[model samples]
Target: MIKIEDITFVAAEAYKRSGLVLSTDKGYLLESRLAPLARAEGYPSIEALIAAARRESNDRLLWAITEALATHETFFFRDNTPFDLFKQEILPVLSRARGNMSTIRIWCAACSSGQEPYSLAMILEEEKARLGGLRFEIVATDMAPRVLEKAKAGVYSQFEVQRGLAIQRLVTHFDQSGDQWRIKPNLRSMVTFQKQNLLENFSGMGTFDVIFCRNVLIYFDADTKKRILQRLAAQTASDGYLIMGAAETVVGLSQDFAPVEGRRGLYGRSGAAKSAAA
Candidate 1:
């Protein structure tokens, strides 16, 4: 058995480095996640793996550990309600507001495995005629480079596809390649995947009309969440929407954003007109 104290210390440091938080109870979870990698590396126990990681010159091992611990569990349209609201209410309004602008920008902050942004692309493609020739640019970012590689590939297993993706869209937008479904090139082209750490400054990415940062902040501590939210707010256009997970809220975190009532998972800058009201 590995010393829980040593494991906790290392885990705490690693989480701090990655801007993720892990409770003491999560030590076992981390042990379980890294067991395979440890075995592959010929390390007898978690302690050996930790020591090796601490001294390893490659740096890839540390990244592998972080990537393994980082959550990449996502699917196309994982939550249906938010995407529906985006299609029915948000996009039209944003499109009208942009008017003659050639492009509309969107960002998927914690875009795990690419589903969320790809789903947005599918919706935009479906509504292209109504968009009146406006180009849509979707920036999908995640901290894990491995997951970003998978996302860039735009290929998903049948089980992954069935998870929130409808049959009609699947049939229309994807190609059957053996056991996996490949998202069509056109839809995939709409999004550009990038490796990003949300905890750091995002000023280089420029402004976005909407940012979907769902379900990823639950892992951060309060202060980390506040800093991340502030950076997210700064990256957003004044009237842009900031969509968070349904279970998450920014009520006391910052005064820059206001909640959108009746529309769960939707938030907008305080001074902006409510999508529901508009």
Candidate 2:
């Protein structure tokens, strides 16, 4: 039997050690996630899993416990409005700014299971001819190696493709692999996926024209959010854009980023906005 209070305490501790701010109101949520993990790992009971969490030698088990709390919903072209803004407003400005050099480099942080990056590849492919000589490259990173490997393989199940993916796009871009759909080689080639932890240093990552860190900040605390925004600012080009989730914001978190005029959920470095104003 799982001791509710004991499992709850361990779950919260694991999340903290994982660098995520676990919500206190999620008692039932933790139980639901932990129950499956306990059963699959051959733990005699959820209590056994909680006890294993206390043991320092079981690093893999501890990590598994922490990772369970990171569950979130993801889909291709998740929120339509942001992608629309990217296509209509952002891309053209960046393309024009590049002038003689025709390249657009974009980074997608916290990309899970490859849907988001694959969506980006599709949009860029559509815009390729219009941009003249511009070549679009995407660097997508997620903290989970398991998911990163899956993303790199460019394969998705029927249910995953059904969400936010239109029939026309499905027919054009994916080849049937048994019951699963695999992204075409050409489209898959456009994105490079790797494992990256947001809390760590990313100085070696060159500045990008646009950075998509959407729907990820809500899981972090105030200080972590601010620190991440600052890191992202350092890696974003002066004229580049940063897009977050619809519900997320930069207000009071970091002064370096300000919302773009007439655009919601889009931000640019304050210094860049000031330069544009001048």
Candidate 3:
């Protein structure tokens, strides 16, 4: 039997390795997530599992525990409003401003299972004419190696495809394979997947013109969020745009990026941080 003390320790360890804050509300989270992990490693119960995790420097086991805790819940073109905002507003401004520099780079930070970046590719394809002469690539990254592998494989089950993806796009961009759908080579080629820990240094990652860091910062504590925002500010171009989750805000978190005027869930590093709210 896994005691409450063991569950608390597990949560602490998860945070140390990955900065994930386990919700106090999920009472059965440890049992639901760690039980299978324990059984797989030949432990009798969650108690034995966590006992071993506490004692040793087992990198493999440690990662397995973290992965179980990490949420991989995501889908294509999630929250339609943002994509529309991108096409109708952000893209045009960026296109005109970056006319001299024909290359554009977008970083899809914590891009779980490839959906978000691929969604960008589809929009890029659809807007190729309007964005004439511009060359763009998406650098999609996640801390979880397992999810990154899934993203790189570019395969999705039927249920995953049905979420937020239109039939036209599904037929136009994916090929059915057995019981799964595989993203076409052309679309898959537009993104490069890498394993990246957001809490760590972003060396060699370079600056980005647009960054989609949605649904990620909400899980981090305040200090971590501040550090990440500062790093994000340094890595974004002077005139870049950042998109966050609908429920997230940088208002009091960091002064580097301000919420763009008239756009919810969007922030811009455009001159002087004028839109920064107190």
Candidate 4:
């Protein structure tokens, strides 16, 4: 069994780096996720690995552990409702509201392995004619370098492509490579991937017309969730929308966003947030 102190150390480190609140009850996750890392890093066991990390003050190993614990199991068009809302509702409104502007910018936070942003790119490509020459900028950010590298390459295994991706979309936007599929260059070019820790300030990134921060806040504590939501509000355009995970809500935690009626996970900037942005 891993020592309680070691588990506590991991939980503390995860919180410090990413604001992730790893509960003591879920300590088995450390053993399951970090066991491979320990073996690959030449440690005999997870306990030995943690011992070495503590003894050496190994920031790199600690970061690796945190990355391992982070949930990266995302697929294309995850949870169809949000993407449907983006294409059907969000786009038309933004097109009219920003007709004078040249571009519509979308931010996909915690974009693991590029699927979410790439899915958006495909929708934008399909709607280009309707948009009347309006350009699109998709900024995809994740804190893990390993997933960022995979996202940049734009390659996916057959099973990965099959998940949440329609066959027609697959044929149109990807080229088959052996048993793997690679997202075409046009779709790949639409997104710019960066390593960003959501715990830090996003001021340098500028405002976004749409922000997809789905399924990420559930990992953080309530206070952390409130802080991130407030920052997200500041970085959203006054007329823009925020799409979160269906299971996540900002009801009591924040007043920066108010839900768009009839839309499960869609939110519009509140009056308070708009005033602050002004």
Candidate 3 vs. true structure, TM-score: 0.93
List model 3 lDDT by residue over 1-278, tens digit each: 45777768777778887788876555488788878878888998878877787789677888888888877889999998788877887777778777944888999999989899999999988888878888897999998888899999999999999999999999999999987999999999999999898988895899898899999999888888888999999989898888999999998898898878777898988463433221
lDDT of 1 by residue, 165-260 (tens): 889999999999999999999998899999898876789999998899999888888888888888888988888898888899998887788887
All candidates' TM-scores? 0.94, 0.92, 0.93, 0.96
Cand. 1 TM to true fold: 0.94
C-alpha lDDT values of all predictions: 0.85, 0.82, 0.85, 0.91
Q: Compared with the true structure, what per-residue lDDT tens digits does model 2 show for residues 90-192?
A: 8778877887457788999989888888998898887777878777779998877767888999889999999999999998999997899999999999998
- In terms of lDDT, the poorest run of 10 residues in model 3 is 269-278
Q: Residue 205 in candidate 3 has what lDDT?
A: 94
**lDDT winner among the candidates?**
4
Cα displacement (angstroms), candidate 2, residue 229, comes to: 0.5
Each model's total of backbone clashes: 0, 0, 0, 0
Q: TM-score: which is higher, 2 or 4?
A: 4
lDDT of 1: 0.85
